[model samples]
Target: MTYVFNPTYQLLVLASAFAAVHLLASGRTFIFASHTILFAALTAVLVSHGIEPYQTTAQAPGGLWVKLFYGAAKATWWIGGALMLVSSVRLFLIFEGRPREGRLVQDLLAGLIYTGAALSIVAYVFNVPVGTLIATSGVIAVILGLALQSTLSDVFSGVALNLGRPYSVGDWIILDTGVQGRVVETNWRATHLLNGTNDLVVIPNSTLAKSQLVNQSSPDETHGVTLTVRVITSRSPTQIQQVFSTILLGGRHTLREPAPLVTMGEMDGQSIGVELAFRVADAGQIITAKNEMLDLIFRHLKAEGLALATSVPNLGVPLNITSIGSAAADPSDQHDAIRDVPLFAALTENELNLLTQGVTRKTYARGTEIIHQGEKSGALMVVTRGVVIVEKELGNSRIELNRLSPGDFFGERGLLMGAEEPGFIRALSQVSVLEITSEDLSKILHARPDLADDLGATLAARLDAEAEYGVATPSMRRPLTIAHRIRHLFQL
Candidate 1:
């Protein structure tokens, strides 16, 4: 007679209750990781007390009277233990910050656990010969493996990549094929990258493993930028290196710690080449820093009277000799510099001539401060040669506010409204500037009251930009308000 009630079945029910409790508490995995391990141990102990799951259903005593029920109990116990082992592995991975990365390893471990449990169920519950079943499975596994050889390669490659960790999420990497992007996610099959065009690129792990990769974000995020400039061999290379030094110094975006490197490269019959190497804060700053460096190169080249070599060879490099700026600019050249300024573009010829009458050309040695922060100046200064940096001092360090190239004007706030300068202007190299005093400005404005509108608007816009970039609190003062202030200040 088949027994309706069995003590062994009752024990299996109790074990199931414990497993339910563990599952219900699994939400607090971090806190319960240790508890899970202990619960796995307990399940293991209870499972061992039974006729080992390796036993066949026929081997279970008849006194239990229900062979089918005994087989199910054995399978349930082993299955429960397998589940607990998988949970323990998951819990450990969670503690190690998995699923973010190294996800494949966890899945592989869980799969192994399930495979073992399945094999045990077949052997103990169904009275199947373990050796025969394994042999059959081995053949099937071989057939499946051959069919999935490509997939297996990707799987193993992913495992290697995760373990090696050449790049992590958010790291910008450059591949051998020039596909560059920031790593967004990595999975068992492929890695996802957000490229510069903001498009998602999915690369299979096997292919990625085979290709050469460069991690730009490694060893800290500072990225090195190298730029090349070729110039006519009119000037000494040492002097050119000095000029390049000034160019690098004027780059507000380049890092100062590594020290900009200027190396003289190959010299042909026509021209010589120079390579400038520098570092920027990160990959994101590369474009901005490169643009700044190119602008500074042109400004310094013009200031030093050096000419960039023409691409058309054999035709001879025609240098733009408008003015050789190495020496102090004469009155005529100074007038041209001031006149070429966009701010004074609207002035009539006579009006521009009148504005230059009292303009004085001043030269400052490299590392000289043209104007201190909060200083009141009665003159408007325009950069005629070389570069100047507007810097805001904060505690021990200084922040670069802006860079002034040729024809760029400063000291306007102090000259126009008698207001203090917002930051200190320092000559990054031996720089030449044309200064127009308030006396000359007064005469010009008297002749043209309409000029106040342009000057005031320009001044307001500059202040607005400075406020946006620097630590200065932006004022609510509008350009119209500033134009009125200029009119009132100049008594126009």
Candidate 2:
């Protein structure tokens, strides 16, 4: 005789198992809770209809409602229990911080367990032969497989991907067919990607499994970017390398550990190609970093008198002086940047234009050392854009004296005093400054003697203020007064 279970008692035990699974599962795995609720509903229907093992719908007494409820409960109970069991296993893996990539395996195992149990119950309790049920199930499976061929392809492809583990969720990927985005979700049928434009792109698992993909976020987030530009052959390779290295080393987004590399690339008759390769903090910041690098390169070439190579009327012809400076920088911008300087405000419009003509616009990336203390370069710099920090070395650490933004000026005291730099100057951001050599200032001072007194007073007062603020001001023994130093240095 086969043993039979009381309907109410069996349901209570099954409900308790599902409830325990749901309670122990991690909150991130919502599938477990959903499947548990479904299983509980099925159990409730079976209890209400008094359906149990060995109880058949064929022997139901009177109402159609009673028979319908019994059939529905019987069909759904085993299938719902299988689903809940599979989901519970997945939740357990997730809670343990293990890979949940064996979802297909869990489903297959659950199906096998449910099928074996169903067969045993039918054979023992209802006296149905197991061989006949196997034959019937085989025929139904063949028909369903043919009808759902496309779905099977996706399922198999998804299984392959899970096993391979090419790209996971939150990874940025680029497909060969030009679809680039962050992977948001991967289901059995399709993978959904969220793109830079904030749109969702859904690709079928079968299609993705066959396509070529580049994972930007695999291994690490550090992304390498290369930029190439052709510079005229007039500039030496050493000068070009120095300019490129400075730009890369001080870049805000660039990684310093790998240390950016600058190499001389292909060379033609008129120009030589230069390449700058560097790694940024992450792949997402590449676009912003590339744009900033281009701006810095353009300005640096202009400052160093290196012009970008362009197509000439004759392939082997050299560029003229006028054509060289044309693309190097905009003369109008240089003039405007010069006029905005307060030290030059004492000069007339014509004098300002003359000074602007002599000025060179230099670009410095963030963290670049613009001027070092005790360096003998007496060039005056006027900030046109971005920011810089002024500091002096005190013992081991450097003391920050001030921050200079756009329209601020520095290094004028060095020019007037005829001495080395007093403090260290560093670029705090991508900075552009108009630099005027002392030679250029000397010419303007010779033209107007009265301008010397005004500039000297300004420079001396600035020196005294910086000294008061703990910045090391260089002491040079030369002139009795600030005005004398300005006059003697400018040759007035």
Candidate 3:
């Protein structure tokens, strides 16, 4: 004869079914395997309760109590199964990496599941019918919704934003309020942005959804950035084009497909303004690229004997011939001394004035010891007016290392390295020098570290090139000779 299951056994079967559903949704193979064992145990317990030789009387209070317990357990099982299904779907969406749309859907579904579970558990425990509890909850929900309308609007707006995909994390956006930044996080109530200064800006999701936004990363990641260069009108348009093209080709960041555009923008009084338009990969690198491009442009122009425009007003006054002669008689002649210095090249009148304040003017007669060998000197000397011979004592003979003219500086190595003078400097002609002490150089460097780095790099390069080639006579004006030029051309 087939055995009829008792109420207690029925309750155990219902609970086991709920547990099995939860385990299946958990999606773990080993955990699912364990759930089979649990299911078997529950079945064994149910079978043992049913097969008991001794049975409780139908009229006994214990039988009625067991029936009530079974009813409650069955309700709990149903509630738990509903919650598990909702939670499982939500978790699956999250794990699949569909956070934008998935999170909102998950939150809504989970909230409903929790509300249902809370009501069901309470009703089951209190012996209240599910229909009556759900009716009461509906009325309470209506009252709460009225009070939280604005807050609810934000929550719903957040959901809309997730679905719309207006902007995602890591995208750079400019809001309608002129606030610009990268999106860092999105939540049910608000979105967070990291501004340029790296400050976090929390904006309401409703506000963001309503405002217009510009996504810099959209369409394409490439951005067109322009650099403007002002050149002297004296430089021919053709030559300017060639020079700019060469510079663009040398730049690592410049895109070749678009070909850097060089347009003559406007003609100013002293300069022919030009705009250099090019495509760059990112906005952050614009400043660095601007600096390097300007440096390269200036260096190329200087090498090509091109001049940039200036806007300084000059005071027209005739020089006193007598004063000029008197000034010429001084150890360092100011006018002639400034002519040959490449370092002073392209400096404006105001810049020259600022330079003069820190410089000491000195005049040297022929054979005068400008710098004594083995002496500690604090100043770097620039040949402003005449030639100076740099000579080092080698054995008994004095080897002439170089002849420096206007624009050339000496004592740089000693000043930079804090070394004693290694060679003697004498006037090849009556020379004038504008001296910059180590202290002044340091102050200038502190004020402009970029200039200091450029100068340091240039000096190091010159030193390396000189060491590779034998030291030349101080009487030689040009640093490079024909043979040196040829070797440089052929050398790898």
Question: For this target, which candidate reaches the highest TM-score against the unseen true structure?
Answer: 1
Over 283-352, each residue of candidate 2 has an lDDT whose tens digit, in order, gives 7788898997886665445545567775565676565433333553443377655655666656788888
Q: Rate the local accuracy (lDDT) of all candidates.
A: 0.77, 0.70, 0.61
Q: Pick the candidate with the highest lDDT.
A: 1
- By summed lDDT, which 10 consecutive residues of candidate 2 come out lowest? 1-10
lDDT of 1: 0.77
The TM-score that candidate 3 achieves is 0.49
User: What clash pairs does model 2 have?
Assistant: none
As a whole number from 0 to 100, the lDDT of residue 469 in candidate 2 is 57
Off by over 4 Å in 2: 1-84, 95-127, 311-492
In the range 337-438, model 1's lDDT, one tens digit per residue, is 876577776778898889988989899998999899889988999887777998888779887778887768898888877788777899988888889998
Q: Name the candidate, 1 or 3, with the larger TM-score value.
A: 1
Q: How many residue pairs clash (N, CA or C atoms closer than 3 angstroms) in each of the candidate models, in the order given?
A: 0, 0, 11
When 1 and 3 are scored with lDDT, the better candidate is 1
| Candidate 3: stretches off by over 4 Å | 1-72, 75-83, 94-102, 115-139, 249-260, 266-273, 283-492
User: Across residues 1-492, which tens digit of lDDT does each residue of candidate 3 receive?
Assistant: 333446466556757665666656454344444445444454455445443212222321346665565445435544544545564555465623656546676787878777776665555444457787678789899999999888788898888988777767767788889998878878888888888788999988888888999887676666677888667765678877766765564445656567788887777555676788887775545656677677656534543455665443376542221221122333243433443355555555655555556777888897898888777667778765555776677779886555565456888656654445556888865666788776555554544444444455545554543452343223221333322332232231
Location of the lowest summed lDDT over 10 successive residues in candidate 3: 318-327
TM-score leaderboard ranking = 1, 2, 3
